[model samples]
Target: MRILFEDSPDYEMVLGDYLERIPISWSRDESFGLLKTRLVAEPETTRDLAEKVMDNREKGGELAGSLLSAIAETSEGQDWMFESLTSGNVRKEASALVMLLNLISSITEPNLDHNLRLLKANAQSVSEDNTHLLLWCLEEACEKERDIFVPLLEEVLRTRGVPAASVYLSRPSLHRERPVSALVLAVEILEEKGLDNGEISLGLIGIYPKNREFVLERLKRWISKGKFPDSHHGMLVAHLKKHDTSPIIALIEELIDSGNRNALYVAANCLEELTQSISEWLGWCEKWESDSNKEPAVIRSLLEILSRLKTYEASGDRIRAIELVQKFASRSNIDYEDSTKHISLGKYSHEGCANTRQENRYTLKRP
Candidate 1:
């Protein structure tokens, strides 16, 4: 609950000002959060207020969904959803239906059948005017339940052709892979538009499993920009998980060779879960060590990775890690040390570090 101070300005006045001015604002989503805070005070009338929000959810373009999506989470807002959908205002209906699609696919209840039936019925009636909203709804729904929405998606693509496919291709999300056919269409769209178009390469659609290596040549800079296991890094991680192959390993190997400490950390972090065998990891270590001019921070991070590696009993497993530890055991690379102690030249009483006898000793960080 918000604490309303006597000295504070009136929420009702503030709400009225926001509701009136926001439609004409240069940016709608900017102050939407403040509007959301004030919006709950009068949920009884939120349906009427939300009708205005839904208007912008349509005409206000992509960013406007911020408020519209938030309002959908409110009980009163949801109660008014079907009313707005069948209210004969195409814009409001489409906006409301997209949120309905988001909810039905993402959450389930006993009455979910009723929602699905209504969704399909309204979806069938979607015309060219509603195609934009239809695709918006399709992306969210299809990603969650391919069995249900892919047919609808396919039908839309069949009817609308490349123009419709181009829409999805431009703004594809890395949250999950789109259907194979949709991606094929996306590839065709890019191929037709030509890779010379700079915008096409920036999309995750280009990274579809087919042209992955080709697209990575363009996206490695972005992957480098990923300093952590962030969403960009996740795209590669997810890419590997999808392919279930080691093609992306070459890319990580390249990043490790770049001699950037963050790149080393990110590359190692990305491979942490790809452990099919010890050889896979040992190969990566050798790749790092093979760089004769490797940065000390990168080497230390490598030490941390191997020292913390899950012990797999085999020839040369952890040998390079031990070798790395032994070589760096005498000198602490404090310049490159991660203050989190994530990377440090350390002497430790760990089973993995038992083989490396070091003069300068600090406890190794552990989970």
Candidate 2:
């Protein structure tokens, strides 16, 4: 049972002991015992995994993860595990490395070195399944990013059937902090695959405009169509390196005037870039204050942006915003408008910092 096969896939295959030559291999019971006795990456997750694996006996990821984790506790055990996984790599089987990725979270890994060797082997994936595993590792690499991760990501993108990877890399990322280098290359790959994604435009944030104009052009269309949002991406337009922002600004103003609550949030979110339109913001504040049917979110965004003027290094704007606050509070015609003395402040409490602008180039004309 202790004999290790040089070809790792042989372990996954069933042997006919009666017709074939007899050989000692680990019994299924023995292997299962080893995995059951060994600890896994995450306890809470492992418990759920164990339940799922029990319900369906075919899933081997948790079993493999358990076995690897148990064996890799010791230096000698780790060496053997690495060697066996390397054999799987030589065979171009993802079974071993899939186990590695399974041990880690879908999001990130706490200790990347534990899987570094397997990850490097996966850079040149042998099949579609192998490339899928590479994308999983790429997500982890992007999460707890390092200098080595970028090259690894590039290699993964260069895999024979890279278009399959675009489905994932081109999706919207909720995380504000993302690996820009990997994402930039990912956007290029997505572009090559002809996958036009408005939600994925954030990946193009810091890409030089001269490097690719089509992406920016597509983003402008999405923004105009409201497929891509400006609310969360305050710095997106600036990062696009477009000298003519007037068209984009007009599109944004159209959204704001459309009376969409979320659009107001977008205006609030992008007030820094929209500072040139201070008069417009003031007008909106006055309009909202005078109207009896205003939503609290609307007022919240207005006040929030005004409150943020303190951090904007613009004294005139700050004073004007403050006075508007006082005037809005003083207005006795509306119900609870004064209670909003702090009503707008109550909805969200956000910290402020100097707006960061990274230089990127793209020529955009509002179509």
Clash counts per candidate, in order, are: 0, 4
Best by TM-score: 1
- Total clashes, candidate 2? 4
Across 1-367, the per-residue lDDT of candidate 2 in tens digits comes to 4432221223323211210122111121244443334233334433343233323334343243333443333454345445545554322133344445534433333445666655666456345544555565566566555577766766666554346446445444444555566666667666677656542455665343443454556554554444554454545656643455445545555655666545444544343453356665555555556554443433565567665554523255455555555555556454333343342222333432222000000111112
Cα lDDT tens digits, model 1, 1-367, are: 5533121235334433444455322122465555555545655444444444444333532222333444555676566567656777666665566556545544443445556666667775665666766776676667656788788777776677656666665554545556766655554565665432323443444455665655556445544665334543444445455565465556666775776555555665555544455566555556555465443434655656666654523325455555555445434454223343464425545654544322122333333
TM-score, each model?
0.43, 0.41
Residue ranges of candidate 1 with Cα displaced over 4 Å: 3-43, 54-79, 86-88, 108-110, 127-132, 172-174, 189-207, 210-367
Itemize residue pairs with steric clashes in candidate 1: none
The lDDT, on a scale of 0 to 1, for candidate 1 is 0.53
Q: In order, what lDDT does every prediction score?
A: 0.53, 0.46
lDDT of 2: 0.46
Q: How much does candidate 2 score in TM-score?
A: 0.41
